[model samples]
Target: MNNKLKLSNEHTLARVLEIKHYTKALFSFKTTRPNNFKFKPGEFVMIGLIIKGEFIFRAYSICSSTWDNVLEFYSIKVPNGPFTSFLQKITTDSSIIIKTKSTGTLVLNALTLGKRLFLLCTGTGIAPFISIISEPGTYIKYNEVILVLTCRYSQELQYFNYKVKQMLKQPYIKLYARNKLRLYLSTTKGSYPYSGRITWLIKSGMLIADLKAYNFNRMDKFMICGSQQMILDVVNLLRSIGYLEGAINNPQDFVYERAFVS
Candidate 1:
């Protein structure tokens, strides 16, 4: 199946906006979007850069909230590789090409509504969480939001921690009595404020306590993103606990996507 389609200029553009450095190799950007363009959060887009008359493209998830006019993405610099090598040097307001028609299954619409929302991710996988966490509607739609992020070390968790701290200062958002958003983090290779992989935490029921969650049930929704292994791990674990998969056509207790192939 030729699922790939060449987009028209209407859906593609070279706009420059903001650039940010998260770690030594990971960075993010915000680009201007066409006035008429709109998309759900967590959808991946074909982003590319023009170099030497060639367009080098890669799949990147949109990390910005849908209400925002501009699109956002979190990226990793591929050493001496196609787009990232040059992308890392891009300053704020630098131009880069983007394709139209973003698509992916990670959007919140794909999952079944539940009493609690579990977002499990690792590394850049936290990209989509940025969008989900920022939306006040996300909190309104679910009773509670619990995010579990894993990285090689605590430093990688800094980007997410900073954003949540900012959200905490929002008076209106914090006003939602039971609509609290919690962050659970683990660092596999290095010591962190929190200890292990999400799978381990869930299996041992440690994450449930850490989030102060009651219990896993069909009344809960789970969004899993990370390495294939992590997704499978969480999926099977959830299934054992009675959670199921979901889609727009047939919403289930859970939905999934790769954060960025780990």
Candidate 2:
């Protein structure tokens, strides 16, 4: 990936069609999709700002499912981030630049078939998991799709609940039933049910205790997304437990990526 971000010639001043605030720092936006544009849900897109004759670009996960015509993204308002500081202020129909290309390793193609799949995340990292859960293949291919989400409080969980309810009602996802999709929220700071950092939850045997119905064997695949340190910590723990990383070209026991920071 390029370290120094620059606007691509293909960038456009697209209009924002809608926005939904999920939390003080978290928000979701929907924009008019460029003509003939196509992308998988888990992919990340480069969004840029063309203001005051200078361009700034940042990567963001495409939160909406592929079947949707418009592009959607869930983002965090980084207090003083060059991009997010302004990106969060976008109102309906405001013009913003978006790159044509979408890329990332979080897509379903990165992992192999497993009896159970764990889509692990924290904070805004839950963006991609929303896409994975809504995809038709998720229910068709995996016996159990458990989304283990970690956040500071339960408010973040509400957005997920809304999305899950919407997904379960869809004709394609109706087959999911209750067993196919399970949610495990680990709230770290707040006094929520299952309170602690996700890393501790897993290492302390608390995670397993929370999901008493099943035991994690090598047969389970894990897809993790979070901060760089969080990814490294989770992957290291998985390795200690015999879980291997997978890829689109070379499948394994797990797959992960650095979450998009503002």
Candidate 3:
């Protein structure tokens, strides 16, 4: 019997360090990061499990800052998802496969200069934003950073809420985050102070009104991640107002990624 791990040249093995479950369906895990592994905030990489001598992989947005020694990922368990069903059962004893390369348009470098940076996401889509916000470079790039997270239930927001609090309390981050970071939570199905889809909140001006922020304009940049429908609706709303989609080579007013959609 062979116990040695086997992986392709482009992949590496990482040991699971910790796991936290936010809800029956939502969970996050941390894994040991290879010394040579590097990525920008908001980028995503392919990760997977080994089963029956076969590797099953999925794209997962990184949830930890680039400077962190360990990599973190947020996930949602699907009833019989090929990857997630097995992934959810993993413990610290497990080792996962991680592809070396990482890429995504949600990165800060994808957007042009802007006064305010708005990060809008739904469900596990909040993963990359967590990495972005935790990066000290993010605070230096914009005068204000707004993170909007919408989920089906209020409980789904607990993990992010705790992360935000931790950032606000960290000495190095608190100084800037306390003044620049703003979080708004919304629930589509359950009771909450804010309710309804984020697209509606934005179009109806309820989100801006609640933030007491200046009206959205060419000078504001947006990063969005969520389901196909959520992304389309939000993109349409922004495009109608003259916002252009951005790319790594071409900087524009907004960018988006669907890595966490599953």
Candidate with best TM-score: 3
What tens digits encode model 1's per-residue C-alpha lDDT throughout 137-208?
788888788888998877777777876776567666567523477777889887677888888998888888
**Residue-wise C-alpha lDDT for candidate 3, range 149-187, written one tens digit per residue:** 999999999889888887667788777676888899999
Model 3 quality (TM-score): 0.95
CA RMSD of all predictions = 4.2, 3.7, 1.9
Off by over 4 Å in 1: 1-7, 169-179, 258-262
In candidate 2, position 26 carries an lDDT of: 85
- Candidate 3 regions exceeding 4 Å error are 1-5, 258-262
**Clash number for every model?**
1, 0, 0
Ranking, TM-score, top scorer first: 3, 2, 1
* Candidate 3 weakest lDDT stretch, 10 residues: 1-10
Worst window of 10 by summed lDDT in candidate 1? 1-10
Error of 2 at 110 (Å): 1.8
Q: Global lDDT of each model?
A: 0.77, 0.80, 0.89
